[model samples]
Target: MEYKWIDNFIDGLIDVYGTKDIYELYDSLEISIRKLPKCNILLQGNEAFYNRNFLNKEVVFIRDDLNMEYEKFILCHELGHAIIHTNIITSAFSRNLLNLNKLEKQANYFALKLMDLNMDEIAFEGFTIEQIANSFNLPVKCLKLLLDSKNQNI
Candidate 1:
């Protein structure tokens, strides 16, 4: 089943945020990330969490221990949840695992969409998969998932 709302949400983001750049989404949406107390267990294990206030202000509590690239991806994913699932102001935690649940999948699609990444721009003709991902500052594992999703959609 197609989740049409995801597309609508993307449009809303572009209209409201005035840009499709992933790095600017948080500031555009007035969302903030708090440095959560880094538990080695949580940091070493890959987990990010987000919550929305009663006033609808959103804050993502992330492990500061995460590398910059991973942190950016998590911010996008959490922003996805905040925008696409507005009613879900309740706290949620996400792990860097291949979660195929509806919400998780929607958030993944949202992240990819916000990134504005297209296969055509990837230019994989002569470059290795790692090269393409590296050039895009993408996590190889997540990029592979996006690639798979894009291919399936095509």
Candidate 2:
């Protein structure tokens, strides 16, 4: 599925929060990811963390117990929400009521871009899907999404 919103938001992010690097981009946007103890009550049993508008700013609360790989992915995903969904923060409607699948997929795309992930960095000729995912510290499912998006672009 094509999501025009992703392109528009990415353009806006590049224009508004452009920086010398990804770390600077995050800083320029004032996006922070804080690690907290794992608690099911916090985000209603979500796997990792959650983002919210706090004091007119965007904040991500990630589980401290998550492994480094999960940490990287979750941080990127929440950052995506902060950048791509900033405008909707003031809306009364719940994001869960929206096309959540599309939103999640868009966030995945946003994350990969922010990470500067290059498929060329990984060898695929003889590697299994699981091997590729493990080598790159990525979830296989998300890797598939990234590959699919890349294929579509090509």
Q: Report every candidate's CA lDDT.
A: 0.70, 0.68
TM-score of each: 0.68, 0.76
Off by over 4 Å in 1: 40-46, 54-57, 89-100, 120-141
* Candidate 2 per-residue lDDT over residues 8-65, each given as its tens digit: 6666767876642545666777766666777746555565544566666666767778
Q: Top lDDT: which candidate number?
A: 1
Error of 2 at 20 (Å): 6.9
Give candidate 1's TM-score. Answer: 0.68
Which lDDT tens digits does candidate 1 get at residues 1-154? Answer: 3655677888887898688766687787778877765774534454676677725767777887777766677778888888777665342443333243767777877777677676765357888778887866766766776777666762
How much is 62 displaced in model 2, in angstroms?
0.6
Clashing pairs in 2: none
After aligning candidate 2 to the native by TM-score, how far in Å is the CA of 94 from where it should be?
Answer: 2.3
For every model in order, what is the number of clashing pairs?
0, 0
Model 2 segments more than 4 A misplaced: 3-22, 89-96
Displacement of the residue 136 alpha carbon in candidate 1, Å: 4.8
